[model samples]
Target: MTKAKRTAKKLHHIDRAMSETAAAERQSGPMRVLAAVNELSDQPPLIALSAATLAAGLVLRRPALTRGGARMLASHLLATAIKTAVKRSVDRTRPHSVDDGYDYRLEKGGSRSHHYSSFPSGHTAGAVAVARAAARTWPAHAPAAAVSATAVGAMQLPIGKHYAGDVIAGALIGYAAEAAVGAIEAAVLPAMTRRSAS
Candidate 1:
């Protein structure tokens, strides 16, 4: 290689090393905070939030808000169902469980089995579903909600709960579930309202 080409290659390696080092530091600092937020992706906390939203909608007499709450809950349900089926059918093991590139397990008995549920993360899927529903209901806060959802899904990596591919799969499933819900609402709600008006 020419002298100038050699210098350029050296600079590229140096820049790559710096970026990796900076990433490590960031993960140890602010990224650790994300761990706490990731816990909210769990079912209990999500259900609590849904219950509160539902109660507020009912007490305030906002049909749209109530429907939003219902949609959030339903989206989560849809994500859960899809993740469960996908996990079973895929039958892939978690990253932490693999060894010698030969790790494998099949989900047996039913949905409760943990043997092969790690290919796509269920928690990440539910988190994204809730966020998507919220975004549809409140357009103003879409950016913040989307960031939160992405963080929750990506957290599965540091937690060793899922592979990167699993996280992507979960997010896609969540998005699709919300889209399905939106389509159904668009088709059915207008007809219901028109019938009620008559």
Candidate 2:
């Protein structure tokens, strides 16, 4: 077998093993507690809270922060598009479908057919992408944004929807996307702004 195929097979095996381990630990009180915490991280209000914070920063006319917020938003959307395309292309089965023993407590109703296609998580990718963008725009807030992004990423763990490796891959993708956006913004936006000013 080719090296790429071997690596794919290895990842599949590792994913299966991790799924089984998560299933084994599903009912442990600590696991339950952690799952609860992860769930709370994305509570409706908290999910919207980030936007509100960014909006407030913009309203206050904080140039650096407003720019950061805008950049983060743009990068996150771009990352989501890329992540979704890749997920569709790979079409790997989600952990839940692979192992019925996994937790289903917090599974969303009417979730799209995720039976196949669980490579990189859109949530993780978007969160990390925005976080990286935010870091570039506002270095002071980057650490906080990263912590928030991590919490968003952790939400996937308890449901056994994705392996830790998947989240890591998504984060890397997000970071790369953020970097690309920054480069484009640096190259294009300033020239446009200068023209508009003149």
Candidate 3:
């Protein structure tokens, strides 16, 4: 084989090895717990609780959380859209689709589609976005928000929906989104307020 062909073959072997390693990791007991937690993170009741907390902060006019809630919500939504687009483009397979040899305790009532792309977890992205925004808006609450984000992220491991790398990528995306939104708000909102006051 030519030198270029040899290099290509080597790369292919590396790819296969990486896939096998990932499969093994997913079958681990701790990973299964992470997957279960990830499924719980998507529960409707938990989501509702988060929404209610945001609403309560706004209704009560808690300066720390009112603006943070609005901005975080916007950033999280934007991150979700971006994540969805990237997942579609890359089309990474979830752990459950890799093989029938691996057992998956899938959450009941969850969508049956095995094709759900798992490049970046939407739940982790949203949670991280909200946590970052909250931390920035209320420095005093940063520790709590950080803890919540970490807990939510840890839950994604065992359910076999996403790998450790997926959660980390999702978190980075969310934090970037939150920062971008915060920058825009800082730059634009004051100007709009001043213009309206004139």
Question: Against the unseen true structure, what C-alpha lDDT does each candidate score?
Answer: 0.74, 0.69, 0.68
Clashing pairs in 1: none
**Candidate 2 ranges beyond 4 A from true positions:** 27-54, 101-112
lDDT by residue (32-62, candidate 1, tens digit) is: 6755666778877877786678778999999
**Alpha-carbon TM-score of each model against the true structure:** 0.75, 0.75, 0.69
Model 1: lDDT equals 0.74
Residue-level lDDT of model 3, residues 1-198, one tens digit each, is 999989976864564344445556676787766666565545343445446657978789885556766776777777777777666555555655655443432222233344446667777887888788778878998999898888776665545556565677788888888889999999998999899999
Model 3 pairs in collision: 31-158, 32-158, 33-158, 34-157, 34-158, 35-157, 35-158, 35-159, 36-159, 38-155
TM-score of 1: 0.75
Query: Which lDDT value does model 1 have at 69?
Result: 89
Q: Give all candidate RMSDs, comma-separated.
A: 8.6, 5.0, 6.2
